[model samples]
Target: MSTNTEARLFSPTTIGAIGVVNRVAMAPLTRSRADMEGVHSELAIEYYRQRATAWLIISEATNISREGRGYAFTPGIYTDEHVASWRRITDAVHEAGGKIVCQLWHVGRMSHVSLQENGAAPVAPSAIQADEQVFLESQTVERPSMPRALETAEIQRLVEDYRNAARRAMEAGFDGVEVHAANCYLLEQFIRDSTNKRTDQYGGPVENRTRLPIEVITAVAEVWGADRVGVRLSPITRAVGDTPLDSDPEGTYFYLAGQLGKLGLAYLHCVEGQTRGDNGAGDFDFKRLHAKFGGKYIANNSYDRQMAIDAAESGHADMVAFGRPFISNPDLVARLRLDAPLAEANRDTFYGGGAGGYTDYLPLADAA
Candidate 1:
C-alpha cells in the first residue's frame, strides 16, 4: 500500500479560471537547446511533453525582442519563425493534455555583446551597468557595456514588444503568457534601486519603479486577458547590482501582489530568491513573502518532494515548482506521487548539448 506523501501537492486545485489536476507546477528552466536564431527545437518538444503531469508548465524564457536575449541557444517569441517553432512544441504539449505558459523576457544590462546586434548597448530604465561577468561557454565574458536609459518613447516600444509577443504566443496555441518581471532581467532592473536610477516619470519612488511592470502587465492582460496573464517576481533576488534588499521585499511584493490580485490574474510565481546557480539564495523568507502575496502563489527554488508537499499542505505555497530535479526526471509529478526514487540528472550535459540529459532521463519503470 502507498502512503500519502503527495496529499497536498498532488491535490486538484484551481487558480483563477484555470483548473489544475494538481498543484505541482513546472517552473520555466532555460535549457539552451534552441536553434541559433532562438527557435524551438524538436528535442524541446519532447522534453516538455514528457513532464505534462504538472498542474501547469511555464516554458523557458523566450526573449521578447532581439536585445532581450541574454544567452545563446535559447528560444524567442518575437518572430514568425520563432512562433512557428514554438507552435510545434505547444501543439505537442496540448496533445499530451497539458497547460503551458510562455515566459516573455528582456534581459536589460545583464547581456553580453556577443548576444546583441552589432553590440548595441542594452536598454534599461537608467544608464547604470550591472558590470557583472556572465558565463556563456567555457570562458566568462564581461557583460555588454552599460546601456543608455530608455527614452519614454523607447519604453513604450518595449511594452509593445511584450504585447506583440503575447499575441503571438496565443496564436501559436499557448494557454497564457507570464511577464518575466523577476530575476534581475529588464523588468526586475526597473523594480530595484541599483539599476533603475532615473529622473523620468518611470523612475524613482516605489510607484515609479513599479510603473513599467504594471504597464507590461496591463498590456499582457489586454492581449491574453487578465484571466490568462501572470507575472513572476524575485524581490529577494540580488541579481546584478540590485540593492536595498527590500528589508521587507515582502512588503514590496505585498503592494505589488495586492495590486495584481485585483486584476484577477491566473497566478503569481515567486522565484523564492536568487537562482544564479544550482544553490539558490541561502537567505530567504518565503513565509513572509507568501503572507503578502495572497493569490495562487507558486514557490520555486531547490524544492524536494516532502518539502513541496509540506509547503502546499501548510498553505505556505499553493504550488511548488521544481527546476533541477525536473531536468532529469521527466515524470517528476509521477515520481513524487508514488514516492519513488528519481534518476539523478547529469549536470554535465545541462547547457549547449544534444538530447543526452535533455530527454534521456528514463521513467520509473525503466529506472527500476
Candidate 2:
C-alpha cells in the first residue's frame, strides 16, 4: 500500500503508437447514456475527460453498424453524425492529457428483435438463441430474439463493417481501436464452439471458428495499423449470456493468440475470468496464453491495487484494465497511487441516466 516510487504500475510505457504515463487503463464500460441513434451525449465529453489520467480509456462497446446494435443507448461509429459526436469526446480527452480508443462491437445473437433493423432477427454463426437479456429502447430487459444463421457470403460484409467502423474511429480522432471479441458477443459467438454450429469455413474446427474474428482484426488493423489495434478476449467468461464456455478454451484461445501474435497487435486485453465475478484462474493457464501472445498483454477482471502492481512488477502484464472502479472514481489513477478509498457507485444510476452517476463523481481533490 506504500506509495513507492518503484511501483511498476505507476511507470510509463508505450502501447503501440500511443505513449501512456502509467499502466492503469480504464476498461470499456456500457453506461447507456448515448441517444437512440447511437450518438453520445454532450455529457460524455466531461465524463471521459474527468478520467483522463489513466494510461488509456477504452470507450464502451460501440456498435460497428446498425445491425451490430444490441442494447439501447450504446454508441456507434458507423455514421458521419457518430463521428462528429465522438470527435468532441476525443478532443476533450486529449486536451486533458489522456489516450482513448474505441472498442468496436457487434452484438450478434445477443440482440433483441426490437434493436435490429425492421425488427429482423439477430444474426449469428448459427441459428441459436442466447439465453441473454438485452436492454430495450423502453429501458426494459428481455431475452434476446432467436438469431438467424449468417450466410457464408454475408461474412465478408461483417468484415467490411468492422473495417468501416475502424475508419470512422480514425476520423473521430481516436488514437486507436479495440475489437470486442469477448463476453459472448458476435465475434466471440463464432470463436466458441458452443454457439457456432456451422460446417462452413467459419465454423467446425478451431481455426475456422476464429476465422471471422481474425478477419475482422485484419480489417481493423488495415485502418489503424496493427500496433494501434487491440483485441479483447474472454477465454472463460460466460457471464454475459449464460453461454457455456468453449469445449477447449485453452486450445482454442492459445491458437488464436498465436495467430494474433503474428500480426503484432498492440495488446491482448484479456478478461482473466468471469467479468464482475471471481477470477476463473483455475479454468485456464493465463500465463501460457500470455507467452503464446508474444506481445503486450493487458490483464483485466477483478484486479485490485496490489494485484495490478504485482502483475506489472513481475512482467506478467504490460498493463492492467479496471472496469467498474473507474465508473465512480474519475481520478482512479490518483486514488490507486495514494491507496485512497474509492467512492461506491450507485447501481440504480448505472444505465440510462443523466449526469447524476456519469459525471457527478468528485475527484479526491474536489472531495477533500
Candidate 3:
C-alpha cells in the first residue's frame, strides 16, 4: 500500500466488510424508469446488471414508507411487492457477480401535495417552507406545502422505517444499505439550519441536527451490521426544499465526518458541490473533510472518467460514483477502462418515460 499516484488506481481496498475489485462505484441516480407503483422492472434489472464491473452499485433513492415518497415513480422497499421487484434486480446482479446496496431515503419536505400518502402535505424537521420549483410532467410547480413538524413519536417512527428498509433490503438479497443523508433530504434538513427551525432536541446545534442521522445509522447498523452499512452525505447540496448551509461548510462537514467515523460504518460517501441550489458545486474546499473521513470515500456529482480516476489516485476518494454518465452508459465501467467515448445522455427522456432514452442507450458498438 504505497501512497503513490499509480498505486491509487491499481490499489485494492476494503471498505469495512465489503471488498471492492477496484474503486469505481455506480452512483445512485433516479431515472424514474420504474412503473407507477415504483416496482423494479426488467429494464432496471438489465440496466444495473450491465455495470457489474463496478465495485458496487447504490440503487436509486428508495422510500421506506408511504410517507417517504417525494418524487414520482421512485422505488420503495416498504412493501412485499417492492421487495419482490427489487429481488429480481439484486438476484440478477448477484448472478453476474456484482455487489449492490439499497440507498434508504425519506425525502422529507421535498414533496408535492399530490405525491404524499392520501395526498397529505409533506413532513420535515419543522414547519419552515422551501418553495423550490420542481418539475412534474410538463409543468413546473412549487414544492407541495409547508411541512408538518414531526412529533418525537413520529421521528422514532421514521427511524424504524429506515431500519425496516434495511431488513427488507437484506431479505431481498442486497449486499448492504447506504443511508441517504445527502442532497438536503430528510437527514440533511435536520442537519442544516435554514430548513430546521425547531426548539426541540432534534433541531438546534450540530449535535442535535446530526442526531436523527446518527440514530437512523445506528438502527440500520443494528440490522445490517456497521460493516455492511454506509452513509452518503452531500455537505454542500442545499437542495430545493432542503436547508441553507454553513458559512464554513468544510469545517462543518469535517467535524461531522469525524463523528461518523466513530460508528465504524463501511464507508462515508460524499459529493463535491455546494448545498446551494445554484446548479454549481458550492465553492468550498473538500481537502480537510476528505482526509478525516479516511475510510472508503465515494465522490459524486458532475464527475467524469479522468477526474474520477484522479480522485481515486490522489487518495481524495476511495472510489468515484458517476450519476449522469451511468444513465447513458450502462457499460460505463468498460467504457472508462477502455478509454472509449460515451454516448450523450438524453435529457428529454431522462424522467417520466418508457425505454426511449432510459434503457435504449446501447454500448459503444451499437452507438457507432
- lDDT pick, better of 1 and 3: 1
Scored by Cα lDDT, where does model 1 land? 0.80
Using lDDT as the yardstick, the better of models 2 and 3 is 2
How high is the CA lDDT of each candidate model? 0.80, 0.93, 0.79
CA shift at 272, candidate 2, in angstroms?
Answer: 0.6
Candidate 3 residue lDDT tens string, 1-368: 33333445545677778887777788887877766576877888887787777768899889888788777778899888999999999998888888999999898888877777677888998887765755443335566577888987788888899989999999889999999998888888888876777788887777787888999999999998999989998876765554677555666677788888888889988767853223233465666776676666777777766676777766777777777777788878777766688888878887777778777788777777
The C-alpha TM-scores of every prediction are: 0.92, 0.98, 0.92
lDDT computed for candidate 2: 0.93
Q: Relative to the unseen true structure, what is the C-alpha lDDT of residue 132 in candidate 3, on a scale of 0 to 100?
A: 70
Question: Taking the tens digit of each residue's C-alpha lDDT, what string does model 2 give over 55-132?
Answer: 599999999999999999999999999999999999999999999999999999999889998999999999988896
Error of 1 at 367 (Å): 1.5
State candidate 3's TM-score: 0.92
lDDT of 2 at 320: 95
lDDT of 1 by residue, 1-368 (tens): 22385487887888766778888888888888887688877888899889887758889888998888877888899899998988988888888888889999998887776778987877878887775565454335555567778888888898899999999998889889889988888888888766778888787777787888998899999998888887898877775544335444655666777777777788888877676543343465656655555677888877777777777877878888888788888888899988889888787787778889898888888888
Which candidate number has the best TM-score?
Answer: 2
**Stretches of candidate 1 above 4 Å error?**
1-6, 135-141, 239-248, 276-288
Model 2 spans with C-alpha error above 4 angstroms: 1-5
